[model samples]
Target: MTNDPLKAAWQTANIPAHDDLQAVVRARGGHPVMSRIRRQLLLEGGCYILFLLVYYDFFDGHRRPLYLNIILVLSVACMLMQHLNGYLLASSALKGPDIFRSLQQKVLQLKQYAWLSVGSRVLGWCGIMVFFCTGITWTNAKYGLLAGAIIIMGVQMAMLWQLWQRRINRIKNTLAELNG
Candidate 1:
Protein backbone atom coordinates (compact mmCIF):
# COMPACT_ATOMS: atom_id res chain seq x y z
CA MET A 1 0.00 0.00 0.00
CA THR A 2 1.08 3.53 -0.65
CA ASN A 3 2.07 5.39 2.47
CA ASP A 4 -0.11 8.19 3.81
CA PRO A 5 1.20 11.66 2.97
CA LEU A 6 1.30 12.68 6.61
CA LYS A 7 3.26 9.55 7.51
CA ALA A 8 5.62 10.26 4.67
CA ALA A 9 6.11 13.77 5.92
CA TRP A 10 6.82 12.54 9.43
CA GLN A 11 9.29 9.94 8.17
CA THR A 12 11.02 12.56 6.06
CA ALA A 13 11.36 14.66 9.17
CA ASN A 14 12.80 11.56 10.98
CA ILE A 15 9.98 11.41 13.46
CA PRO A 16 8.99 7.75 13.60
CA ALA A 17 5.47 6.36 13.84
CA HIS A 18 4.47 4.04 16.69
CA ASP A 19 5.06 0.75 14.84
CA ASP A 20 7.86 2.03 12.63
CA LEU A 21 9.59 3.39 15.67
CA GLN A 22 9.79 -0.11 17.10
CA ALA A 23 11.51 -1.27 13.95
CA VAL A 24 13.85 1.68 14.12
CA VAL A 25 14.79 0.71 17.65
CA ARG A 26 15.41 -2.93 16.62
CA ALA A 27 17.28 -2.13 13.43
CA ARG A 28 21.00 -2.01 14.15
CA GLY A 29 22.32 -0.37 11.04
CA GLY A 30 22.39 3.06 9.38
CA HIS A 31 23.02 6.77 9.97
CA PRO A 32 19.52 7.64 11.21
CA VAL A 33 20.49 7.22 14.87
CA MET A 34 23.69 9.17 14.41
CA SER A 35 21.83 11.94 12.58
CA ARG A 36 19.36 12.23 15.44
CA ILE A 37 22.23 12.43 17.91
CA ARG A 38 23.88 15.16 15.87
CA ARG A 39 20.67 17.13 15.65
CA GLN A 40 20.31 17.05 19.42
CA LEU A 41 23.90 18.09 19.94
CA LEU A 42 23.36 21.04 17.63
CA LEU A 43 20.29 22.08 19.60
CA GLU A 44 22.21 21.79 22.87
CA GLY A 45 25.05 23.84 21.46
CA GLY A 46 22.70 26.84 21.20
CA CYS A 47 23.21 27.54 24.90
CA TYR A 48 26.66 28.86 24.09
CA ILE A 49 25.14 32.01 22.64
CA LEU A 50 23.34 32.67 25.91
CA PHE A 51 26.59 32.11 27.78
CA LEU A 52 28.33 34.65 25.59
CA LEU A 53 25.56 37.15 26.10
CA VAL A 54 25.83 36.74 29.85
CA TYR A 55 29.59 37.08 29.73
CA TYR A 56 29.56 40.23 27.63
CA ASP A 57 26.80 41.88 29.59
CA PHE A 58 28.21 41.16 33.01
CA PHE A 59 31.86 40.13 32.86
CA ASP A 60 33.30 42.28 30.09
CA GLY A 61 32.46 45.60 31.67
CA HIS A 62 34.86 45.50 34.60
CA ARG A 63 37.14 43.13 36.50
CA ARG A 64 35.02 40.01 37.08
CA PRO A 65 34.02 39.48 40.67
CA LEU A 66 34.83 36.08 42.26
CA TYR A 67 31.22 35.12 43.04
CA LEU A 68 29.97 36.07 39.60
CA ASN A 69 32.77 34.19 37.90
CA ILE A 70 32.06 31.02 39.90
CA ILE A 71 28.34 31.20 39.19
CA LEU A 72 28.99 31.71 35.50
CA VAL A 73 31.23 28.69 35.37
CA LEU A 74 28.72 26.53 37.26
CA SER A 75 25.86 27.68 35.06
CA VAL A 76 27.70 26.78 31.87
CA ALA A 77 28.64 23.40 33.27
CA CYS A 78 25.08 22.64 34.37
CA MET A 79 23.66 23.67 31.02
CA LEU A 80 26.14 21.48 29.21
CA MET A 81 25.34 18.47 31.38
CA GLN A 82 21.60 18.98 31.06
CA HIS A 83 21.80 19.12 27.27
CA LEU A 84 24.07 16.13 27.09
CA ASN A 85 21.71 14.05 29.22
CA GLY A 86 18.76 15.01 27.05
CA TYR A 87 20.70 14.19 23.90
CA LEU A 88 21.56 10.77 25.24
CA LEU A 89 17.97 10.04 26.22
CA ALA A 90 16.50 11.16 22.92
CA SER A 91 19.08 9.34 20.82
CA SER A 92 18.83 6.01 22.55
CA ALA A 93 16.46 3.31 21.33
CA LEU A 94 13.28 2.99 23.33
CA LYS A 95 13.79 -0.36 25.02
CA GLY A 96 10.80 -2.68 25.66
CA PRO A 97 7.70 -0.59 24.86
CA ASP A 98 7.49 2.38 22.53
CA ILE A 99 6.11 4.38 25.41
CA PHE A 100 7.20 4.08 29.02
CA ARG A 101 6.85 0.59 30.48
CA SER A 102 6.27 1.85 33.97
CA LEU A 103 5.14 5.07 35.53
CA GLN A 104 8.72 5.52 36.76
CA GLN A 105 10.37 6.03 33.35
CA LYS A 106 7.65 8.42 32.32
CA VAL A 107 8.01 10.35 35.52
CA LEU A 108 11.79 10.30 35.22
CA GLN A 109 11.88 11.68 31.68
CA LEU A 110 9.32 14.31 32.61
CA LYS A 111 11.33 15.30 35.64
CA GLN A 112 14.51 15.33 33.61
CA TYR A 113 13.10 17.71 31.01
CA ALA A 114 11.49 19.80 33.71
CA TRP A 115 14.79 20.10 35.54
CA LEU A 116 16.54 21.10 32.36
CA SER A 117 13.98 23.83 31.71
CA VAL A 118 14.06 25.02 35.29
CA GLY A 119 17.84 24.95 35.36
CA SER A 120 18.00 27.06 32.23
CA ARG A 121 15.65 29.58 33.76
CA VAL A 122 17.69 29.64 36.95
CA LEU A 123 20.83 30.27 34.93
CA GLY A 124 19.17 33.17 33.15
CA TRP A 125 17.97 34.49 36.47
CA CYS A 126 21.51 34.27 37.78
CA GLY A 127 22.71 36.29 34.84
CA ILE A 128 20.08 38.91 35.52
CA MET A 129 20.92 39.02 39.21
CA VAL A 130 24.60 39.31 38.47
CA PHE A 131 24.00 42.14 36.05
CA PHE A 132 21.97 44.02 38.63
CA CYS A 133 24.27 43.31 41.55
CA THR A 134 27.37 44.33 39.62
CA GLY A 135 25.84 47.71 38.78
CA ILE A 136 25.61 46.87 35.03
CA THR A 137 22.17 48.52 34.83
CA TRP A 138 20.60 46.60 31.96
CA THR A 139 16.91 46.76 30.98
CA ASN A 140 16.81 43.36 29.27
CA ALA A 141 16.63 41.12 32.34
CA LYS A 142 12.85 40.81 32.52
CA TYR A 143 12.57 40.38 28.77
CA GLY A 144 15.33 37.83 28.75
CA LEU A 145 13.64 35.80 31.48
CA LEU A 146 10.34 35.94 29.65
CA ALA A 147 11.95 34.85 26.39
CA GLY A 148 13.70 31.93 28.10
CA ALA A 149 10.45 30.75 29.64
CA ILE A 150 8.71 31.02 26.27
CA ILE A 151 11.41 28.91 24.62
CA ILE A 152 11.02 26.12 27.17
CA MET A 153 7.26 26.24 26.87
CA GLY A 154 7.51 26.17 23.09
CA VAL A 155 9.53 22.96 23.13
CA GLN A 156 6.88 21.09 25.11
CA MET A 157 4.06 22.59 23.05
CA ALA A 158 5.70 21.66 19.76
CA MET A 159 6.16 18.04 20.83
CA LEU A 160 2.54 17.72 21.89
CA TRP A 161 1.32 19.42 18.71
CA GLN A 162 3.24 16.98 16.54
CA LEU A 163 1.90 14.00 18.48
CA TRP A 164 -1.66 15.28 18.21
CA GLN A 165 -1.33 15.90 14.48
CA ARG A 166 0.09 12.45 13.96
CA ARG A 167 -2.76 10.78 15.82
CA ILE A 168 -5.41 12.68 13.85
CA ASN A 169 -3.76 11.84 10.54
CA ARG A 170 -3.45 8.19 11.49
CA ILE A 171 -7.13 7.99 12.36
CA LYS A 172 -8.08 9.58 9.01
CA ASN A 173 -5.90 7.12 7.17
CA THR A 174 -7.49 4.15 8.96
CA LEU A 175 -10.95 5.49 8.10
CA ALA A 176 -10.01 5.90 4.46
CA GLU A 177 -8.72 2.32 4.35
CA LEU A 178 -11.97 1.02 5.81
CA ASN A 179 -14.11 2.99 3.29
CA GLY A 180 -12.03 2.14 0.27
Candidate 2:
Protein backbone atom coordinates (compact mmCIF):
# COMPACT_ATOMS: atom_id res chain seq x y z
CA MET A 1 0.00 0.00 0.00
CA THR A 2 2.82 2.48 0.86
CA ASN A 3 4.73 1.69 -2.35
CA ASP A 4 1.58 2.02 -4.48
CA PRO A 5 0.74 5.53 -3.13
CA LEU A 6 4.35 6.75 -3.54
CA LYS A 7 4.46 5.54 -7.15
CA ALA A 8 1.14 7.22 -7.89
CA ALA A 9 2.44 10.56 -6.49
CA TRP A 10 5.67 10.36 -8.47
CA GLN A 11 3.84 9.56 -11.72
CA THR A 12 1.50 12.52 -11.25
CA ALA A 13 4.28 15.10 -10.87
CA ASN A 14 4.53 17.60 -13.76
CA ILE A 15 7.80 17.85 -15.69
CA PRO A 16 8.77 20.65 -18.00
CA ALA A 17 9.40 19.80 -21.64
CA HIS A 18 12.85 19.90 -23.23
CA ASP A 19 11.90 22.94 -25.31
CA ASP A 20 10.74 24.72 -22.20
CA LEU A 21 14.05 24.02 -20.52
CA GLN A 22 15.90 25.29 -23.57
CA ALA A 23 13.88 28.46 -23.55
CA VAL A 24 14.72 29.00 -19.90
CA VAL A 25 18.42 28.37 -20.46
CA ARG A 26 18.50 30.85 -23.31
CA ALA A 27 16.56 33.40 -21.32
CA ARG A 28 19.31 33.37 -18.74
CA GLY A 29 21.56 35.20 -21.23
CA GLY A 30 22.07 38.40 -19.22
CA HIS A 31 18.52 39.63 -19.10
CA PRO A 32 19.33 42.42 -16.67
CA VAL A 33 22.54 43.40 -18.41
CA MET A 34 20.94 43.33 -21.83
CA SER A 35 18.07 45.49 -20.61
CA ARG A 36 20.40 48.07 -19.10
CA ILE A 37 22.65 48.19 -22.15
CA ARG A 38 19.71 48.50 -24.52
CA ARG A 39 18.32 51.37 -22.49
CA GLN A 40 21.68 53.14 -22.55
CA LEU A 41 22.06 52.62 -26.29
CA LEU A 42 18.61 54.09 -26.87
CA LEU A 43 19.42 57.16 -24.84
CA GLU A 44 22.79 57.67 -26.50
CA GLY A 45 21.35 57.11 -29.95
CA GLY A 46 18.70 59.70 -29.34
CA CYS A 47 21.29 62.19 -28.24
CA TYR A 48 23.36 61.50 -31.33
CA ILE A 49 20.36 62.00 -33.56
CA LEU A 50 19.59 65.26 -31.85
CA PHE A 51 23.18 66.36 -32.24
CA LEU A 52 23.01 65.64 -35.97
CA LEU A 53 19.84 67.65 -36.25
CA VAL A 54 21.36 70.73 -34.68
CA TYR A 55 25.02 70.44 -35.63
CA TYR A 56 24.84 72.53 -38.77
CA ASP A 57 23.64 75.56 -36.85
CA PHE A 58 25.02 75.06 -33.36
CA PHE A 59 28.43 73.66 -34.29
CA ASP A 60 28.94 75.49 -37.59
CA GLY A 61 28.76 72.38 -39.71
CA HIS A 62 27.71 74.76 -42.45
CA ARG A 63 31.08 76.53 -42.18
CA ARG A 64 33.09 73.32 -42.31
CA PRO A 65 34.38 71.90 -45.57
CA LEU A 66 32.19 69.41 -47.45
CA TYR A 67 34.58 66.57 -46.64
CA LEU A 68 34.66 67.38 -42.95
CA ASN A 69 30.88 67.55 -42.80
CA ILE A 70 30.63 64.28 -44.62
CA ILE A 71 33.12 62.63 -42.30
CA LEU A 72 31.26 63.81 -39.17
CA VAL A 73 27.89 62.68 -40.52
CA LEU A 74 29.20 59.30 -41.58
CA SER A 75 30.95 58.69 -38.29
CA VAL A 76 27.91 59.64 -36.24
CA ALA A 77 25.67 57.52 -38.42
CA CYS A 78 27.99 54.53 -38.10
CA MET A 79 28.02 54.86 -34.36
CA LEU A 80 24.25 55.16 -34.30
CA MET A 81 23.89 52.04 -36.42
CA GLN A 82 26.25 50.16 -34.13
CA HIS A 83 24.21 51.27 -31.14
CA LEU A 84 21.04 50.00 -32.79
CA ASN A 85 22.79 46.73 -33.60
CA GLY A 86 23.78 46.34 -29.96
CA TYR A 87 20.19 46.82 -28.87
CA LEU A 88 18.98 44.24 -31.34
CA LEU A 89 21.71 41.78 -30.43
CA ALA A 90 20.80 42.05 -26.78
CA SER A 91 17.18 41.30 -27.54
CA SER A 92 18.03 38.16 -29.51
CA ALA A 93 16.45 35.14 -27.80
CA LEU A 94 16.88 32.35 -30.31
CA LYS A 95 19.79 30.17 -29.26
CA GLY A 96 19.65 27.71 -32.22
CA PRO A 97 18.28 24.24 -32.82
CA ASP A 98 20.50 23.01 -30.03
CA ILE A 99 22.12 24.67 -27.03
CA PHE A 100 25.70 24.22 -28.22
CA ARG A 101 24.95 25.36 -31.73
CA SER A 102 23.12 28.39 -30.46
CA LEU A 103 25.95 29.33 -28.15
CA GLN A 104 28.45 29.03 -31.00
CA GLN A 105 26.29 31.28 -33.11
CA LYS A 106 26.11 33.75 -30.26
CA VAL A 107 29.87 33.75 -29.86
CA LEU A 108 30.32 34.46 -33.54
CA GLN A 109 27.82 37.30 -33.40
CA LEU A 110 29.49 38.79 -30.35
CA LYS A 111 32.91 38.70 -32.00
CA GLN A 112 31.58 40.59 -35.00
CA TYR A 113 29.87 43.14 -32.77
CA ALA A 114 33.05 43.62 -30.80
CA TRP A 115 34.91 44.53 -33.97
CA LEU A 116 32.14 46.89 -35.03
CA SER A 117 32.11 48.56 -31.64
CA VAL A 118 35.83 49.22 -31.61
CA GLY A 119 35.98 50.27 -35.24
CA SER A 120 33.09 52.67 -34.85
CA ARG A 121 34.65 54.20 -31.76
CA VAL A 122 37.91 54.82 -33.57
CA LEU A 123 36.22 56.20 -36.68
CA GLY A 124 33.95 58.51 -34.69
CA TRP A 125 36.88 59.75 -32.65
CA CYS A 126 38.89 60.50 -35.73
CA GLY A 127 35.97 62.16 -37.51
CA ILE A 128 35.18 64.47 -34.63
CA MET A 129 38.82 65.43 -34.23
CA VAL A 130 39.22 66.20 -37.93
CA PHE A 131 36.00 68.23 -38.04
CA PHE A 132 36.87 70.30 -34.99
CA CYS A 133 40.52 70.90 -35.76
CA THR A 134 40.18 71.68 -39.44
CA GLY A 135 40.58 75.47 -39.40
CA ILE A 136 42.68 75.74 -36.30
CA THR A 137 46.11 77.33 -36.72
CA TRP A 138 48.37 75.03 -34.74
CA THR A 139 49.75 76.64 -31.58
CA ASN A 140 51.56 75.29 -28.50
CA ALA A 141 48.44 75.41 -26.32
CA LYS A 142 46.31 73.84 -29.06
CA TYR A 143 48.86 71.06 -29.48
CA GLY A 144 48.80 70.46 -25.73
CA LEU A 145 45.00 70.35 -25.72
CA LEU A 146 44.95 67.91 -28.62
CA ALA A 147 47.45 65.68 -26.86
CA GLY A 148 45.31 65.68 -23.74
CA ALA A 149 42.20 64.85 -25.74
CA ILE A 150 43.94 61.98 -27.51
CA ILE A 151 45.11 60.56 -24.20
CA ILE A 152 41.59 60.71 -22.80
CA MET A 153 40.11 59.08 -25.88
CA GLY A 154 42.76 56.35 -25.74
CA VAL A 155 41.89 55.56 -22.13
CA GLN A 156 38.19 55.46 -22.91
CA MET A 157 38.79 53.14 -25.83
CA ALA A 158 40.86 50.82 -23.66
CA MET A 159 38.15 50.68 -21.02
CA LEU A 160 35.37 49.97 -23.51
CA TRP A 161 37.44 47.25 -25.19
CA GLN A 162 38.13 45.67 -21.82
CA LEU A 163 34.42 45.62 -21.02
CA TRP A 164 33.62 43.93 -24.35
CA GLN A 165 36.38 41.36 -23.81
CA ARG A 166 35.13 40.56 -20.33
CA ARG A 167 31.60 39.91 -21.57
CA ILE A 168 32.94 37.77 -24.39
CA ASN A 169 35.17 35.85 -22.00
CA ARG A 170 32.27 35.15 -19.69
CA ILE A 171 30.31 33.62 -22.56
CA LYS A 172 33.38 31.69 -23.68
CA ASN A 173 33.78 30.29 -20.18
CA THR A 174 30.18 29.16 -20.17
CA LEU A 175 30.73 27.48 -23.54
CA ALA A 176 33.88 25.85 -22.23
CA GLU A 177 31.97 24.45 -19.28
CA LEU A 178 29.37 23.01 -21.60
CA ASN A 179 32.00 21.52 -23.89
CA GLY A 180 34.14 20.15 -21.10
The whole-model lDDT of each prediction reads: 0.60, 0.88
Model 2 ranges with Cα > 4 A deviation: 1-34
Q: Write the per-residue lDDT of candidate 2 for residues 1-180, one digit (tens) a residue.
A: 356987888888798996788688668865577768977997998999999999999999988889999999998998898888888887877578888888889888999999899889899889988998999999999999999999999999899888988988998998899999
Model 1 C-alpha lDDT per residue in residues 18-41, reported as the tens digit of each score = 778667755865357666776766
For each candidate in turn, the TM-score is 0.45, 0.81
Model 1 RMSD vs true structure: 10.4
Give the top-scoring candidate (lDDT): 2
Candidate 2 C-alpha error for residue 58, in Å: 1.3
- Score residue 112 of candidate 1 by CA lDDT: 54
Sliding window of 10 residues with minimal summed lDDT for model 2: 25-34
